[model samples]
Target chain A: MKILVPVRRVPNPDIKVRLKSDGSGVDTEGVNFLVNPFDEYAIEEAVQIVEKGGGEVVLVSIGTADCEETLRAGLALGALRGWLVETDEVLDSAAIADVLAAVFKEESPDLVITGKQSVDTDNNQAAQMLAAKLDLPQACFAFKVELGDGKATVEREIDGGLDVKEISLPAIITADLRLNQPRYAALPQIMKAKRKEVKKVSLGDLGVEAKSATKILGLAQPPARAAGQIVGSVEELVDKLVNDAKVL
Target chain B: MSTLVIAESRQGDLRAATYNTIAAAKAKGGDFDILLLGSGSAAGADSLKEFGAGTVYYSEADAVAEYTAESYAKTAAALVGEKGYTAVMMGATTTGKDMIPRLGGLLGAGMVSDVIGFDGANYLRPMFAGNAIATIEVNTPVAVMTVRETAFDAAAPSGGASAVAEAAAVGDDRAKFIEYRLTESSRPDLGAASIIVSAGRGVKDAEGVKQVEALADLLGAAVGASRAVVDEGLLPNDLQVGQTGKIVAPDLYIACGISGAIQHVAGMKDSKVIVAINKDEEAPIFEVADYGLVADFAKAVPEFMEKVKALK
Candidate 1:
């Protein structure tokens, strides 16, 4: 099985995020970036699948040169190779899928893996959109996966319960946090990844132009959370939930 | 046109998400109608009727049997297409983020995941985990968005609602149902709890967590751990309350023995109220906390529990 892992590199999880000058996007002027935590699980899972089942793990990403860091990180974690679908501007989910669909056509990965959602956009739509566009089976929020006998079984999270799903090979699955522990890159592997090939393909060069069917008019900020009223006792708190706030 | 708030329910009662979505839909300041899509969840519709759901289109059929992404997306697309809702709102839980876009694709509607608030086409959402916020509006006929549960208020039940059941256009079996396994962990629901008492590496290990959990139980809160604790395997990944683990907007979020990290704060900063219990008064969490208690957590836990029990 040849597994494909698409990832996003977002600002480090440690910094207080600032908006761009125009408030159009995040201010990444001096923020550290890393592989999206959930996508790390996807890459790790794909590598494990290939390690066990005998195939290649291909790391895929859609971003600018900055995202090369994320792709390289995936390579260090055990992916066989890395590919970059370079774009000038941020691509929306469907547009991203359009470019990925082209890659799918060429690579023909037996199993395509993605994080449940991108940590930055948190759109959580790429894998499903790709599956819909490619007309393939999609199992999402998967915490566990098994592939054997030409079929893949995925454990999915449902409302108040769980439902198991089985799909044929050549399916798409999105990884959730509960899937598995993503390993830290060994220093030796990181050194080796420096020698590995990370091929970058521009959207224009790939003959795929990013055209969004929907246009973003603008972004808004969430209401500032009010300063909490700290009460003297738990009894007062329960009273608020029961009488004042009436949540309980 | 009407608003479509996908009501989330469990064990015949509505989840906090349903109420949050309802409050948001009403923010449009118009006639509100809700769609309850699930397997044999008619009770959810009945309970939610008092929330001024002028109409309830409940789906009861094989299509709604389980949360198959294909079925929900197909059915939701058909519903929105046929009824022509002003907006199709969903709870931005794990399920909504996965299913909404598929529905958007099926109906050829515009998709926006994790919309905390909106002014016309512009919507508010978080970036860099939850440290910064962004607003974007889509110029599309149908705007399908996932409601950030932490951002909206739970709508109160009001008068009455007219409920109707419809056969789902999408069949549950349209796509194959995959295997699902549930992992049970010790910590309380980081996102849904009223009081979340979290510990970081300062707590030391599982035994140290027991000290924190003991205090949490006395206070009727859930146990949460920092990413550091989670990274050290002192707790499960689900118990990690941070940008990467679970972003909880509970009523009262507390930190015990934790030196606040940005990732940890990003997960709980939106909480309605906060208290920090740490030795270091200068911890970043204290900056956002409404109340600060500087003391040795080892001593603080027993003292706090004693006070709580005495109050009780």
Candidate 2:
């Protein structure tokens, strides 16, 4: 089984994201960047599956040349190699899906795994969009996935429960929080990752254009929350909640 | 140029989020229709008739009885094409999030997800864990979108029945639904609850979790837990409230023993009123809370139950 896992580079989630004063976009001055947390889960899942079944895990990403750093990190996690769709253009989810579909046709991997959504945009649309673009079956927000008999059984995390779905091979699966704990790359693996091959390609080479179907008008900080008062006792808290807030 | 609202149902009952999606479409100031699919769609269609829809289209074929994105997206896309709908909308529930993007892909339309509000013709959606709101514009001729249910009010019946129509069902050969294992709970659903009592790592153990539940039962509120508690196996994953979990905006949210990580704050900061109780007075959760108490939840919860009972 050859598994294709798409990853992304995002602002380190630990740092508080700040907006520009003019409401244009996020202020990225000195902010650290790393692999999106959800994509790490997808990479780990794919690597583990390949380790057990005697196959290969391949990583792909779209971003500037700096995204090679992101691919190397995935390689250290056990992927055989990487492919970077090098571009600096900001593409929306539709454009991203179109590019991935092009890569799917070129690589012809048996399976595709991706993060449910990037933490920055939080759109949560790419995997489903990609599946639709390719006319493939999809299981989104997968908590547990088992592969055998030319099919995959996925336990999906839905609103109030888990929905079990079975889809044929050559399908799309998006990782959720409980899929697996990602492992840290050891120093030896990190050094080896530096030498692993990462093939560079352009959108033009892939027969896809970086066209955005959506435009961002502006960005602004959310309204500030009011400072709260600390109560001295539980009686006072109840009195305030009942009389002042009337929320009880 | 009319909008189409996709109605969602489970176990033969219409979900409240469908009404909220209608309200969102109404807020956009346009004539909207309803599309009901799946096994019980005919019965569900009857309940949506008075919601001011221009029409209520439904399909109850066995092939489309359950939702598989491949089938539903094909069906919805075909209907959108037949009707020439300019915009399509649904509540940003799991079903909507799972299927609508595929609908957008099939229609080759630009899409937006989890829209909280509108700014003129553009959209308002959260980013970076709700720390910033971005205004977005879909440049496609046909636009597909999902609105956050908590951000809109449920549409009431408008005293007029809409024209009902039957739609063709589409089937998928690549996927099959097996089963849904729902969490059995008598308490109110966390998403729709008016009051929520949430516990944190400070709860310590399974016994501590029961204390939080007891307080929730007394106040008739839903019970929630922080990610730490859920990760520790003291609670089910569905009971978790945070960025990666369920996002709830209740009328009153009482957080006990939670330290208020930014991810947790992102999910609940939009609540109408927030109360935080923890031994550490300087926990970050206190920043967004309207009321803060510097005491251990184990000691304060019993007092809270006693005081609430006396008032009632």
Candidate 3:
């Protein structure tokens, strides 16, 4: 069995992202980029599954050469090897899915694991799109996943609570935030990962349509909230809520 | 062009998300059709007529009773694709987040998730956890979207009844639903509650969560928690209110010991009136709070509870 985990390089979640002056895109000038926080969880889960059972974890990402660093980070974390699907064009969730679907056909991995969504675009779409494109069953928002008997049992967090689902192998699974805490790359492992070269694959070679259908019209800051006034005491706060706001 | 809105219900009762998505459809300024899937779906369809749905497409099948992502996504995609609807919309709930993209991919359509505003052509959605907004445009034949319910006013439940028709059935059993375990609570749902009392990391322990719950019960409000507290295992994940959690916009939101991270604010910033109670006066939560009280919440929350009790 082989596990294929897709990773993405996104702006650091803790940093505030600024929009370009002309409103075309986000400003990455002074921002630091790293493996999308959620994808780290995916990588962690992939490694755990392969370590418990007998399999190899293959990491794949779609981006430019800049993504090799992210792949190496996964390598340090325990992925057997990596494939960087290098493409300079801005691909939407749909286009990215096409590229991954092509890779899925070539690799024929037993499972495809990826983050629920990229914190950057906040578009929780890619994994679902890949599932659709490849005609595979998808278990999303997975908090707990178990692999055995040629099937995967996933506990997914839904609207009200959790639901347990059983999907056969050759499935796509999206990792939720609570899945697992990613471990830090140890110093020796980081040194070893530097020597592990990632294979670079061109987007054009896959022959998948790599253009995004969506367009960004503009970007703006949401309306600023009105500045609040400090109340003298809890009594004043309750009074304000009862008399002024009438919320009580 | 006509629009289609997917109606989601749990255990035969329509959830608030159904109404919110209908409201989003109404924002597009035209008559729209609503699609309801599952057993006893007609009742859900009947309830949705008032939400400006001129027609309801009721889809029922045994497999639709238990929601498998594949089945729901395929059903919706097939319906929207067959109808060639110009716009397909739904609430940005967990189910919507899971299903919308599959529909978009099947139709080769561009999708905007967690949409806050839709002005016919352009969509306004939050980026960087609500620090900035991105207005996007989709040029595909059909536009698929999931609206952030909190960003739009919920559609009214009273209006002229719409016609209901049985829609075509489409699904596959690639996955099986073993069971669902829901957190049973008598209190109002956090997403639709008019008032919310939310606790954060500063609350410290499960006992702290109880104190906040006591305050919430007094006001007939829903209990909410910041992602930090939920992640810390002091509260359940469903109560979490943040970027990755449930987005809510209640009339009054009282933050108890919550230091406002942008992710936390993104979930509740649309609240009509926000009250922040924290010992740290410099917390970013104060910037958005309509009323700020700088005090240790241990002292302040009890004071609030006592005052409301005395007033009652």
Candidate 4:
């Protein structure tokens, strides 16, 4: 069995990002980047499944040369190899799904794991779209997964509760939070990853049509809530909640 | 081209999302027919009709008794394929979030998720975890979209009658639902709660969590927690309110000892009235809070409870 994991590089979640004045996109200059936090869980889950089931884990990231660092991070975390689909052009979820679907056809992995959504775009579409494009079953928001006998049982976290689902091999599964805590790649592992060669897969080679179905017309900062005055005492706060706010 | 809005229900109760998605469809500037796909009773369709959708199409089968992205998407995609609906809308709730993308993919349609508003053909949604908003335009002949319930008002449920039509059954055998475990809580559901009292890392132990819950019970508010607290094992994951967790816009949101991160704020910032109580006066949460109190939650939470009880 072979597992394919897709990782994305996104701005550090802690830092407050600002939109460019021209509204083309977020200002990425002088900003730190890291593998999307959720994607780290995907990488970790893929590594664990391989470690238990006796197969290899492959990491794929679709972006420019900057994404090589993210793929290396996945390799350090225990993936056997990396595929960097180098594309300087920005790809929407649909286009990204097309690229992954093509990879799915080429690699024919038994399973594909991905983060439920990216912190940057928060679209949460790629995994399901890929499943549909590949004509496979999917389980998103997977909190727990057990693989056996060519079948995978997934416990998914939904809005109200949990849904336990069972799907056959050659399926797509998206990881949610609480799936597992990603391990820190030790210094020795980092050195090994540095020496490992990352194969580049280009959009032209995949023959994936990458036209975006949607266009981002503009970007702006969300309206900020004005911080009100600090209350001197608890009574003062309660008075405002009851009278001015009328929420109590 | 006619639009179709999908209706959702849980445990036979019409979900607030059904009405909220109706509002989103109305915001797109036209009336729409609605479809309820499940074993849910006719009351679900009748309730949706009150939201102003005049035509209700439905399909039911034992195979789709439980919601699965595969089955629901198949049923909805079939309807869209047969009717050639111009747009299909649903709320970006957990079910819709998982199902809409699959439906869009099957139809090869352009999709916008978690949309807050619509300007003609453009859709407004958050980016970078709510730090910024982006307006997107879809060019596909058929557009599939999900609405951010917090950004739209719930449509009134008293409009008029709707004609009911039974649609063909859709089927899929790709996956099986084994079981479901619903969170049992006496408090109101977080998404529909009028008031929410959320705790953070500062509330150290299980006892501290109890204090937050007690206050919530007294005020008839739902209990919520920051991701930090939930990750620390101080509360259950269901209680988490953040970007990865539940997004709530209650009338009153009280943050107890929560040092606000952007992720946490993204879930509750749209709250009508925010009150932050933290010992750290400079906690970023105060930046979005309507009222701030710098004090230890152990001392502040109990004292605030007393003040509220006195008001009663």
lDDT against the true structure, per candidate, is 0.74, 0.91, 0.87, 0.88
* Model 3: per-residue Cα lDDT over B1-312, one tens digit each: 889999888778888888878878877777789998887798888777766677898866786777787888788887887877898998998889988888888788888988888755788888778878888888898989899998777788667778888887777777888898888888899987999999998888888889999999999999999988987878777888988889899999999999999789888998999999999999989999999999988889998899999997
Largest lDDT belongs to which candidate? 2
Model 4: residue B208 alpha-carbon error in angstroms = 0.8
Ranking by lDDT: 2, 4, 3, 1
Which candidate number maximizes DockQ? Answer: 2
DockQ, computed on Cα atoms, for candidate 2: 0.83
Q: lDDT per residue, candidate 4, B136-244, as tens digits?
A: 9888888898888898888887667888887666666878878887777899889889999999999988999999999999999999999989888787677789888
- Which DockQ-derived CAPRI band holds candidate 1? acceptable
lDDT of 1 at A113: 93
Fraction of native Cα contacts reproduced by each candidate: 0.44, 0.82, 0.80, 0.80
Instruction: Return the candidate ranking by DockQ, descending.
Output: 2, 4, 3, 1
TM-score of each model, in listed order: 0.87, 0.98, 0.97, 0.98
RMSD values, in order shown: 4.0, 1.1, 1.5, 1.2
lDDT by residue for model 2 (A1-248), tens = 89999999999876779899999989999998898889999999999998899788899999999999999988998899989999988889999999999999989999999998898888898889899989999999998999979999999988887899999999999998888989999999999999998989999999997577798888988888888899999999999999999987
TM-score of chain A of each: 0.92, 0.98, 0.96, 0.98
What is the lDDT for B277 in model 2? Answer: 96
* Model 2 stretches astray by more than 4 angstroms: none
Candidate 3 Cα misplacement greater than 4 A, ranges: none
